[model samples]
Target: MSIPHEIENYIKLQPESKRNDMLELHERILQNLPSCKLWFLDGKNEQGKLVSNPNIGYGSYLMKYADGTTKEFYRIGISANTTGISVYIMGIDDKNHLPQMYGKRIGKATVTGYCIKFKALKDINRDVLEQAIKDGAKPRF
Candidate 1:
């Protein structure tokens, strides 16, 4: 797949030392996410070309329902700065019932429209996170 020119340029501009690390990180995210159609959006750049900030506006991974009869939902991206990775999941509504079902794994979650912002990945369980991504998505139709 061809990455957007901006993303390609951005990656090309990264320091050679950090390039491999970022590539692996990006690949890990893609691997962890369920197989689906991948799309890229131009992330905002307020603080220059550094990838450390939440510069990549919103990155979405689209997944289809099991029956393939429903709409495809988005797993929004959140940059985990301290951890040097991004976390993907469904938004606020998904996080609502998560605490009871996920307990301490959820830690704390903040809502923003249909999306939720959280701090650490360790705070949420992987199974819970994946389920949230699946449940958080809305029908495309």
Candidate 2:
């Protein structure tokens, strides 16, 4: 019903190992972005078909589209995937920025345009990951 309740329920539904990691990431995000707006998406498209994994979102920013329209979306997000977890750092204009800046330093994580996906918390450099999150959380407009 509530954003936090939904997030906690989602994380609790994860496997033990993943649950702990997800909880930790959730706390970390809250600590880093203390006043952020929280969100929970049940991974369905408008048609209610399962499209993506459930996402726990943080912060807020205005996103502008090429069509000269804008919408508010989360600045950072975390989700449990089939293999591991995905940390989404939305609003980066340069697709290459993340991979170039954090690909090598964030350990085994895959640094895409707006996501850092890893198998486990211990597999990556947490500090670099935090910095990346902070970088992405900066004002988007």
Summarize candidate 2's per-residue lDDT along 1-141 as a digit string, tens digits: 898899989999999999999999999989989999999999999999998899999998888899999999899999999999999999889999999999999999888999999999999999999999999989855
Task: For model 2, name the residue pairs that clash.
Answer: none
On residues 1-141, what C-alpha lDDT tens digit does candidate 1 reach at each position? Answer: 454454455445556534444454355445554454454544445665554443232234344566875543345553434433344444344445544544445445543344445544444355655555555443332
Note the Cα lDDT for every prediction shown. 0.46, 0.93
Q: What ranges in model 2 sit over 4 Å off? A: none
Work out the TM-score per prediction. 0.41, 0.96
Clashes of 2: 0
Cα lDDT for residue 102, candidate 1: 46
